[model samples]
Target: MNEQLTPRQLMILVAYFIIGTTILVVPSALAAEAKQSAWILQLAGTGSGLMLIALYVQVFKRNANSNLFQINERLFGRWIGKGISLTIALLVFVFCAQVLYYIGRFVTTQIMPDTPSEAIHVLFIITVVVGMRMGIPSIARTAEIYFPWVLLLFIFFILFIMPDIRVNQLLPAGEFESMSLVRGALQVMSYSFLPMFVTFASLNAAYDWRSSMAKAFVYGTLLSGVMLTVLVMVSTMVLGPDNTTTQLYPTYVVARKINVGNFLQRVEVIVAFLWFILIFIKLILYFDVVIMGIAETFRITKHAKTLTVPVGLLIAIFSAVVYPDYVYQQEWDNTTWVAVALLIGLAYPIALLFLSLFRKRKAAAK
Candidate 1:
């Protein structure tokens, strides 16, 4: 908890942040819009991500000595900064709850159909709450340790599923409405790229002097983008865009297809577990960010852990009631979540960067 994140840790954190729930849900999300062109449209998201990485890295480099709290206060003044911080915290809290919902919904529907969603939700939230209460370094370290296993499993999954990809499935990229393609790209960016922007407020993962956070973030985004592109391609090829779109968890469905001479069958559960691990990492990171934000807003300098249990309790109950089912979740993800993510992730950072630059020039002119 007391340790600072290294370059490697920062890169891993960003990768996991982007990968979070994006991998689990992206196939269906993209298929709904772009269909067979889901692969190409996802690559478009990398462009959006590169643009965001540049803006956020500038923020990170300029405010190396300050956390997001101090940077916001310095840039926007106290009242506005507090308001901004509260918004960021709320987003983080909601995101945490969403991630938990993903775990519960996945487990209940796929693995443990008879198990109560509330039971799964409580068990999962407890893990994240404990890890988060430890501190930023703890969260970063957890990412560092598990990232390799995730990378290996993901790559192996892609390889094992390679023989299943059909070239014809990804064809007909030109037929879709360009607006639909554009919308698909936006959804990809919202899921993959914008997370990079939101996490700037979680700069509690605060980089050490030896590492360049901007460079680490660029590397991480590129790697995660590549992974996402491959996943989209694979999903479209193996499952066909139609199947991918219809299945609620297409990636998990795709994973169920792994079989090499029947020796490596039923390994889809491994992929499912990996997704759960990724969700845990995601939820914990957001949980820590919200707690830190609240403490900063109220000037709770010490013993912030006191707030953890109650907040965790709130998150648990909230997750249970957020959406009655996955349909409502899908609706929110498609509509309201976009505006929320863009406001906090895109608009806020860009505005802050402009203000910081303007203020610097004003000071210089003075």
Candidate 2:
């Protein structure tokens, strides 16, 4: 028996997943490539992402009572629908692992330089597993409680770091290249919101499927885009593009620069604290989706208890082995892999929309 989530719970899950660790990494990375135009890329990416969301909305609107798994079964027939469901489940598993890996690596390298990546990974996994075992309602409740603190901390961090920002450093005033911005935005769209398709699909099974999903998506995108744009602009102003490109954690570096008189020095600790909370929320949401997905596919009754340890172990092992080093990972992300992601994330939904339409028309003619 699958449990249904309320609309408020669904909204929190969407918001938390959308705002995860990517918030920490993306601004610096996009700024490195797009520079002052990074915000433009983010805006363009959000627009492109919304188009994909529309396709998803169309599918859900057509079959408002069914989840993606059920929709797949209807659209593709029994065997193929099962295959599609498994494929989506596997993708969510891999995504969850990769997110955990990235968070562990970030913690080890940036905040606690002395801590082993394995130790960090284990601790992170433990926290996520505990949350997943508690069920979706618990996770949603946790977010509601912590969300205000997360927002407050983010505001404080941004304000405290503003004093260190050098406005002149933000510009030699380069020409705006529209094409480059579009390309960069396309890249972001591939990685960021596309993953949310799976989550949205999963949640649709349990929530009231309608325009509300689209509303949540738009709100989440706008919130994430604004934060990312501010982070990029601030990092550019403080570190300059050339230097920002070379740095590992440009936002962290910017946070380290905060110095308010003699009293408020060493505020990077606070930044790390806030980021840890966000990352934990992200990990838990992904873990929840993966567990729920596996249970739904296999027709299991008690999902929360059954799959927790196995998935955690799988993520731990895979995260350690996913990349030889950060450079290789970055290269893979920037090159052909992201293009493949765009196809899966963006193109796949559009294909489904067309197929659904053709099916409807043929049935109507008959």
Task: For candidate 2, write residues 1-366 as lDDT tens digits.
Answer: 235655555555556666676666677667766775566666677778677767767766776667677677778887887788778777777777777778878888877889888888888898888887787667777887877887787788889987777888755544457677777776667666777666666556555654366576566666666776677778888888777777778878888898888788888877778777777877776676677666667767354467899989898888787766888788977776576677666676676677788889999999
Clashes of each: 0, 0
Best by lDDT: 1
Residues 207-280 of candidate 1 have per-residue lDDT tens digits of 76555766888888888888888888888899998999998888888999999987988899999878877778
Taking all chains together, the TM-score of candidate 2 against the true structure is 0.91
Q: What is the TM-score of each candidate against the true structure?
A: 0.95, 0.91
lDDT of 2: 0.72
The C-alpha local distance difference test score for the whole of candidate 1 amounts to: 0.81
Determine which window of 10 residues in candidate 2 has minimal summed lDDT. Answer: 1-10
> Which runs in model 2 stand beyond 4 Å of their true positions?
1-11, 172-176, 301-304, 362-366
